[model samples]
Target: MLDCKPASTPIEANHRIKADMGDPVDKGQYQRLVGRLIYLSHTRPDIAYAVSIVSRYMHDPRSTHLNAAYRILRYLKGCPGKGILFSNSRHLSIECYTDADWAGCLDDRRSTSGYGIFVGGNLVSWRSKKQSVVARSTAEAELRSMVSGICELVWLRLLLTELQLYKGG
Candidate 1:
């Protein structure tokens, strides 16, 4: 795909990954591609959410999943130099935001939760994953996401404490 056209975005906003959208494709190759994307997401937060969504189909990837994977690759190609960028800042503070797609999954109706933690206005940590339990209400879904974020915050605080980066808990 070296000569393939690259895309500016990893996936289209309106795109959906239905379980039975298309014919089944090679599972091994699809899994490998998703694995590489997962590794890349460590530093490329822009693609983290998209990669997480695509990785869900590793067991039985369809042609649609393959296409979505290709779109992510194209996105990387278009923005070859895109990655984490840290700026010089004396002040550091942890600010978190969380959200959820209440029962957004088309097949089993599992909600997806996401959180992003920013340090001094720059993103430092993020996650996007399917919720363990099905949330019956939007409020419940949001609470679930907030709980995940709080866990991350607690861990971050502990890490900072161990490193002596923060003065107090």
Candidate 2:
């Protein structure tokens, strides 16, 4: 990463990635690169969206698609220390926030949904995935995103509850 060049943005805002109908590349290498990026998403939330976008094209990636993935790696190289930091604080509250872009995917016309869950000012979980169904309206897309966020909340609640019970709460 240190030897890679930095990208101006993690992903191109105006660019839309789709299943590459173009020439195919080495399947093994493509999958390996995407897998690496997915692993990196565990700590680098900033690259999650970009990596998710490019990963969909892994079945038949072209030079353009590979370049996009490489750009993300370059960005990662420049910001190696970029990650969430948990502080030693007594505050133990859990909260979730969500947002969505209706018809965000240009190719399939599906919406993009994102969510972030935090506990005591530390981001515990986050995600960005395209909705399975195409939403007719922005409100509907947003509602779908809220549902995803709620799922995260439930899991986090259960986790925190277990921790509390272990501590004899």
Best candidate, lDDT: 1
Clashes of 2: 0
Clashes of each: 0, 0
The residue-level lDDT of candidate 1 at 90 comes to 67
- With a 3 Å backbone cut-off (N, CA, C), the pairs that clash in candidate 1 are none
Q: Candidate 2's residue-wise lDDT over 53-78, tens digit each?
A: 88878777877778788889888777
Error of 1 at 13 (Å): 1.0
State the weakest 10-residue window (summed lDDT) of model 2.
160-169
* Candidate 1 CA-lDDT value: 0.89
Candidate 2: residue pairs that collide: none
Model 2 superposed RMSD (Cα):
2.8
Per-candidate TM-score against the hidden true structure: 0.92, 0.88
* Per-residue lDDT over 7-123 for candidate 1, one digit per residue giving the tens place of the 0 to 100 score: 989988867688888999989999999999999999998898889889888888999989999999999999999898888676667789999988888778888999999777778
